[model samples]
Target: MTLLSLFTQARTYLKHRPYPVLLMAATPGSSFAALPGAQAPTRGTGTSFLQTFQNYAFDGFTLIGLCLCAFGIILVGRHALGVYHEIHMGKAKWADLGSTAVVGVCLIGVTIYLVTTASNIL
Candidate 1:
């Protein structure tokens, strides 16, 4: 609780830093190693935690994009099927197909945009 105790704690922490700390000083383009098992660093690659975070974040974004695409496909399929049934029964006009197409195109565009820009977010 006292300043001396805090100083002592800090001193102890520094004295017993793990082995990675020593290795990191010699590693290129990194303050510390990235997530364990990440590929070795190259020209633009890195062993920093930031790179690891970006990799994980990009994966999360990709998963979200995949889910969105799946949902979009399901939505478009269901809408088209319903409209087809209506047309067969003489309850719907051909113009409804335009709306369904528009919805699908818009979803595709949005997903493409998000996937392309997701990396820039970090």
Candidate 2:
């Protein structure tokens, strides 16, 4: 198969599971984990009902970011599993598998780099 076709297939797969991509792209405060400890907020300070509500509302971004990161990880894992299954079923060539593996490794590496480097600028 042509490289274009392979990309088209990947696009189709992503289209069918758009949430992961969306989450990865749009998660709010996702870089909080990479912030300096002093810059990060402490938990459990708000005890009053209104204070609690405000805290939850603002802190929800961090929670969403965390969830999105988890979802993205699961999605990558599923993609790898799908590729492996295709190779096992003889539906994909060995070269395709090798290329896919390389791409997967690069993807994971980039993801790690992004998560590790994400900070105020991000």
Measured by TM-score, the strongest candidate is 1
lDDT at 32, model 1: 46
- For each of the candidates, the C-alpha root-mean-square deviation to the true structure, in angstroms, is 13.6, 20.9
**Model 2 Cα lDDT, one tens digit per residue, 10-120:** 999998999998888876678666776532233454768777666565566555655666777777778777877888898877777677677877776776566555532
Supply the TM-score for candidate 2: 0.43
The parts of candidate 1 lying over 4 Å away from their true place are 1-54
List residue ranges in candidate 2 displaced over 4 A: 1-58, 112-122
For model 1, the run of ten residues with the poorest summed lDDT: 37-46
- Span of 10 residues, lowest total lDDT, candidate 2: 36-45
Q: Who wins the lDDT comparison? A: 1
C-alpha lDDT score of every prediction, in listed order:
0.75, 0.69
Write the residue-wise lDDT of candidate 1 on 44-114 in tens digits.
34478898666666677777877877787788888888997898899988888778778878977887777
